[model samples]
Target chain A: MAISSFHPPQRTLMGPGPSDVSARVLAALARPTLGHLDPAFIGMMDELKRLLQYAFQTENAMTFAVSAPGSAGMECCFVNLLEPGDKVIVCQNGVFGGRMKENIERCGGIPVLVEDPWGRAVDPDKVEAAFGANPDAKFLAFVHAETSTGACSDAQTLCAIAKRYGALTIVDAVTSLGGSPLKVDEWGIDAIYSGSQKCLSAPPGLSPVSFSDAAAEVIRQRKTKVQSWFLDLSLVMGYWAGEGKRAYHHTAPVNSLYALHESLVMLQEEGLEASWQRHCDLHQQLKQGLAELGIEFIVPEGDRLPQLNAVTIPAGVDDAAVRAALLADYNLEIGAGLGALAGKVWRIGLMGHAANQRNVDYCVAALREVLSR
Target chain B: MAISSFHPPQRTLMGPGPSDVSARVLAALARPTLGHLDPAFIGMMDELKRLLQYAFQTENAMTFAVSAPGSAGMECCFVNLLEPGDKVIVCQNGVFGGRMKENIERCGGIPVLVEDPWGRAVDPDKVEAAFGANPDAKFLAFVHAETSTGACSDAQTLCAIAKRYGALTIVDAVTSLGGSPLKVDEWGIDAIYSGSQKCLSAPPGLSPVSFSDAAAEVIRQRKTKVQSWFLDLSLVMGYWAGEGKRAYHHTAPVNSLYALHESLVMLQEEGLEASWQRHCDLHQQLKQGLAELGIEFIVPEGDRLPQLNAVTIPAGVDDAAVRAALLADYNLEIGAGLGALAGKVWRIGLMGHAANQRNVDYCVAALREVLSR
Candidate 1:
């Protein structure tokens, strides 16, 4: 059988992630590939780290991008910071937090899960109670913005509660980073992992992660070797730490990093606060339009993530048929609910470059047409 | 402090891996970001698997690309197949073999080392003897082509010996797949992994891997869960299988997979035998030119990989200074030796798109000029 080059359709990505990438970012991705250790490439990597630090709003020396996706970045935090028999308090409200539990278990850490109902923020009181009961817990982990439910947790409150109990925090900022107000250093987030495809407006593949000094110190003092060698921060830091004479790690995803650098630079140019406001403004517009169509949100207004809007599927509306129609007719891609919310909700994303009046209007009109038909 | 967008210099990459991506592949990478689970994206992924199967020359149903780099692919093989308390025979001749040992230990498997000198291919006799000594060994893992030492082991002979002892074999074809002759099914390799950056002429980040029916069965029947959830084949297969309703794994590194698809398509256009011959032809040209400058190869002609030429550095040559001059003065990048051979050898790569006569001539001329200075 003969195969030819794939010409992907120009998609309006209004899904959970891989949010619409700007042409400038795409152009950056197509730039000439360079050797991972090339001096010029290394210089660019240093700048990439700086840009990531700014996006994360932290001065973490261990800030850099993981070569894989956000899942691997989540593993990096757990496998490095927690060892066998270590106790951790994990809050589960969405798919990502559940993944954190899996990572903890794989690393041989004992997890005490604080459960929250779906379409709701992680209950800070429940997390505090978990810490109170398991006073020896070494880490407190939760998702800052749950992509599966579009629920936004209060990361600062959770981190402060964890710190009061002397437990470090690992936050999943995959869908929250640039779309919302997140101050890593000021919020006392010890370790945070995010994706380039979300609010960063880059293509998928690279995961931007940061570790504070306290988190770095815990990794340095590990009694056991990191369970997953590929996700080990101790060795990864040597490659990303742009000090004198950098060490060789794996060949970084050179082109993906190029895309990330461009996206982060755009974030810097727009300023983090402005990017957050843009997402919020677009969310308001989308909300008003959806409400007019008699659609209801799964998450409450106060707890909703501006970047990702989770709405209840109206009765008698075939969930798959509507989403399929949206893609087939409008060339728009919105997400279907995952896990417990499967077939019950649709996720509409207004993230990074996708957060604009044009996309919002197109999405609303498309939904109206599809629903009416 | 303000930072501008990064503009990487156009470099002629003649390194160990990431050996010059083609413009078409780069363009494919930048085409358009798609939601990972989009129907069109899934169609592209199905085609990607077919293309990968052709490249690996396998009928293995479980063939697909890992979302991370080659190292993660390596971990995937070990973590999925070998559980705690299992014994495996690991052949250590170069850098990657040593890494396999680390992965085995991290997975709680006992590794019986079959040691060969650096720059030498794996000895089948030593492997058989290790099997003789440890009759209960579950796996035999070795590198088919050692990128660090530019040595090509006899994969067919090694796999035949491992099968005789009822042990599954895992082959690292990172630098071998397109540049050399490798038949995964015919060679009886139970599992194999390759990097996209090397012979595929794609930018770094994706690892194309294949598992034989026997290997997949072992993974399916594992008593314990795969240690790394992100790299776990059990979960990953559902997403890549593409036969029925595809399951969602981590967002499929959508753009990277697009680049891999284009590269594999190009590989099909140029027949595999032709690609191998091209690398061999370029290697001969490079070898003769290096010999004229009084440089010698570390590996014997029979064992040396045609794509990666490892040559002994002159006794008094300032290795770093020479490499820096090649980069700054000529815009060419060659790799320095790693681990045991560091500072003693230079690795000049002629793989995929970089294996043309123009690159060969330019690399030799640049080396001659830099060496004379």
Candidate 2:
């Protein structure tokens, strides 16, 4: 059996990421594939690390992109920092937070769970209380912007709380990096990971991550070898460390890095704060439009994420049917609620290149036409 | 500080892996990005699996591409199959075999070393003896093609030997697939992994992997959960399994899959045997040219890999200076030897779309001009 070339249909991606990539990033992905060790390529890699530092709002020397997706980035943090039998304070409010617990446990770390309702922000007081109860906890982990429920937690407050307990923090900034204000250094985040497709406007593949000096030291002093060699920071650092003297760890996803470098360059052109405001502005426009259509949000206003808007499914509406119709009729893609919120809510995303007045208006108009029928 | 878009220099790639990619694969990568769960995207994914199956020459149901590079693929096999305290025979011929041992030790498995010379294939007699000494060995791991030394081992004999001792086999075919005769099913390889950049002529990133039915059964009946959640086969299987009813694992490298699909399609069009023969033909041309220039191969002819040629550096020649001159003067790239062979040898790759008479002639002509200077 012979397989032909795949020509993907043009899509308006406003779902839980891979949110619309711009033509610039796509063009970058088509650039000639260079040898990973080529001097010209290494120059671009150094610039990429600097650009990633700017996007992450940190001056971390350990900042680099993982050659895989976001989940691998999460695993990298857990495996490198936590050892067998270590204790961690894990906050579980949405799907990604649950995944964090799994990472912790798989690394042989005992997690003390801090639970909150799905559509609400993680309760900071509860996290503090859990830390107080489990004083032996070496790390605190949570998601800043929960894509599953569109709830935004107070990262600054949580990090401060963890610091007070003498514990390091691992923050999942996958949905918050460019769409929201995330100051890795100012907020005292020790280790943070974000996805390229989320708000960077690159295709889904690379995970941009940063570790503070303190976190790097902990990795350097690890008592046992990292469980996942591919995600191990010690070995990976050698490859991503210096400009000309770098060692070969693995063949980087060359084209994917090209796309990411372009996306980060675009991010620099439009300043970080301006990008965050754009997301907020588009979310406001979408909110007003949805309100006029009698749609209500699942998350409260204060706890909501501007990039990911989770809303209640209207009574008597067939959730999958409506989403399928929108895709079939208008080529618009929104996300269905995952895990506990499945069939109960719809997640509409306004992220990076997808966040604009035009996309907001088109999504609102498409939903109205499909729902009223 | 502002940064401009990166325009990478166009260089002829002839490194160990990440060989020259075709215009067709690059164009496929630049196509519009799509949602990972979109129906049309799912259709492409199903097609990708079928294409990968054809490339690996297997009918195994658990065939798919890992969303990372080859190292992650190596981790995926070790973590899922071996558990804590499990003993395995690890054959070491070059850099990758040592990496496999590190992976085993990290997974808490004890590695029984079966040592061979650096530039030679794994000795099948030594492997059989190691299995005899360690009757409790659960796995026999070896590299089918050592990219570091340009040696190709007899995968058929190794797997057959492992079977006789009631041990599963893990084969690293990173540089062998599509460039040589690798019959996954006919050789009875239990688990195998290959990189997209090597013989497939796609850009770096994405590891195509396949597991026989017996290996899949062992994974299903594992005593403990897979150590790394991101590389967990049980959970990943759910996402790659089923047609149109797939579950979400992580967001796949969407555009990378497009490149792989195109590469595999090209491979299918030139039949596997034809592709292998192309590499062989190009290798012969390169060999004759290099011989005239007084270059000597590191590996014996019988065990040498046509895709990767490791040649000894001539006495009194400045290795780094010559390679740098080749890059600067002719816009060409070759590989420096790794590990013990570093500075003593140079690796020239002839794989996939890079395996052609034109590249061979250009490489030889460039090398001769630089060396004579």
Candidate 3:
């Protein structure tokens, strides 16, 4: 019954999510507990909103972190916005896009899917054609950066097309938000959701989401109540938004929000453009290193996300074995391909706090050694 | 855009969770992130499962923390265990119990109610009567510790009665697990869910849940798919349980598990019996002090939970003013009444590391001073 201290092995997290959390964010996670409704914590909550707005590039006013991870964020958007029998168009290029389809179907909405090949960006023309065919579609859902495939879709164009088709847009910015360019307002996105762990480099468990006035109006006019009461943004908004009289929903995750606040602060300090550039620069460095080692990327140069690098497994190399060896030998962690790409690709992420010159160099060198062995 | 260092006010957290996290757990929270699938982290996950099993007092192999809060944990249990048209008898005493009903109804199940007054423990006889009337009821669900009322129910007796009727039991032990005696296996409970932030004193992200083999069998025999693919325990168990291999689930929260592991270690060091005794002793001291100040209890003595003390609001005392004074002037927090008891009672929580002689003294002295003003 002796209390053993937790001793975690330090690893360079270059995976899709839970990207290496900064020490400052970790310290924030260690902040002394505050009551969810304490004025001081409320003040922190307000600052967190402003920071989230800055990170998401939206002034939607209904922006806050869902108490769960990114998948719940997706559920929140769908459950709150789309009622039963609503027709929605889901553009699927990777795992997250398919999740959106699942969410739409789960909400009892009809999903009009526009399929794209894995490891490729969602084609705006294909989406436009889908919308043209299904003119009654109420919303357009797509992944901005598909973590499963390391492809960055053209969200700006897709949202524009959806807007033209009189459809609200729901973008999955889970893996893209902090590491790439995402203009939620300028792109006319109606609703967007992102995770804290991926590009935000906080521990997973808070999902940041923003709803445009249009999306909020749709929620306001819902004929049926949101089926899942917990993810209902209407009740959640009363707690997350407002001046003084915030209604109690459930207990807010205080320390996780503190970590998120610090992570956003770090993101703001680095400046979004600079952070995006850093990811690009480090990804280029990694790409050059991998190219030198005779590795080919699954995603082509033009469509690949700087945050996630998907490489085709070489003929003689074992994808799982290489990842395992990297984890064991160098304490460097990366992601394996998911779903269709499973065992076919290795995902090397240079994301958020870990997207730096040294880590790119280190990961490439480590992969080379593991591949050779 | 400057990276400001995070400086958290050192407040005494006496409100409902996130209760005062100990310094040791806070240090554990700041540990480096590890890959969820990393061998070392998987080792931690294994240890975490064992510790949670010890805490829940269940030998169920299907035990682990859901990568979300208590609410999602509630969703997981209901979504996984109940299929479409399943009849569940929900004993509603407070908000969380209402949430269980919501979870059941959302999963396309029928909710049979056994209503209790908000501030009272659920009547086992009422539950039995409901079961007798609705013979198709598949399970009995209730909150072990009604946080809204600070009332404790007889989970053991309820579970025993359910077992006699050939029904399973789902217990919401969110606020009860560590602070009170939760004999999951001994009580014949089928499934139980708890929060990390309550008595475990970790940050509020992970939810510890355990399912008996009987409940697991029900999940295995489900005729329809669980609506929530993310929370489907069948898939989650493949990742959280078993040996040698783990299928992909969502990325687990790494550092949060580290903190949870440390908190459970702390829990074991104190021993469950000692921890329960400490809570009871602190509650008695607080009761004596509050009685000295002419305060009366909301629930009868035997039915009240030791960790959550609900006191009737004194006449001529501004509930908001006293709570604000405690928070703003003394950096102390106390919970406000919820639901029907709102403005009629004050819920003061002395949970996890917060349940100690010194905290009880400080909280009493602070309340006395604030109330005197």
- lDDT string, candidate 3, A1-373, tens digits: 3437768778999877779988888889988877778777788888888888888898999999998878888888999998889999999988888888988887889999899999999998899899889999999999999999999999999998998989999999999989999999999999999998988999887789999999999999988878776788878889998789889887788888899999998888889999999989888898899999998999888999999999888898877778878888898888888999998988888889999888988988898788777
lDDT of each: 0.93, 0.93, 0.88
Q: Write the per-residue lDDT of candidate 2 for residues A192-293, one digit (tens) a residue.
A: 999999999899999999999999999999899888889888888888996459898999898899999999999999999999999999999999999988
Model 3 clash number: 0
Candidate DockQ values, in order, are 0.88, 0.91, 0.62
lDDT of 1 by residue, B74-169 (tens): 998999999999999999999999999999999999999999999999999999999999999989999999999999999999999999999999
**TM per candidate:** 0.99, 0.99, 0.97
Give fnat for candidate 3. Answer: 0.62
Better of 2 and 3 by DockQ: 2
Select the stronger candidate by TM-score from 2 and 3. 2
Query: What's the number of clashes in each of the models?
Result: 0, 0, 0
Q: Is the docking of candidate 1 incorrect, acceptable, medium or high quality?
A: high
Interface RMSD of 3: 2.1
lDDT string for model 1 (A170-204, tens) is 99999999999999999999999999999998998
Using DockQ as the measure, name the better of candidate 1 and candidate 2.
Answer: 2
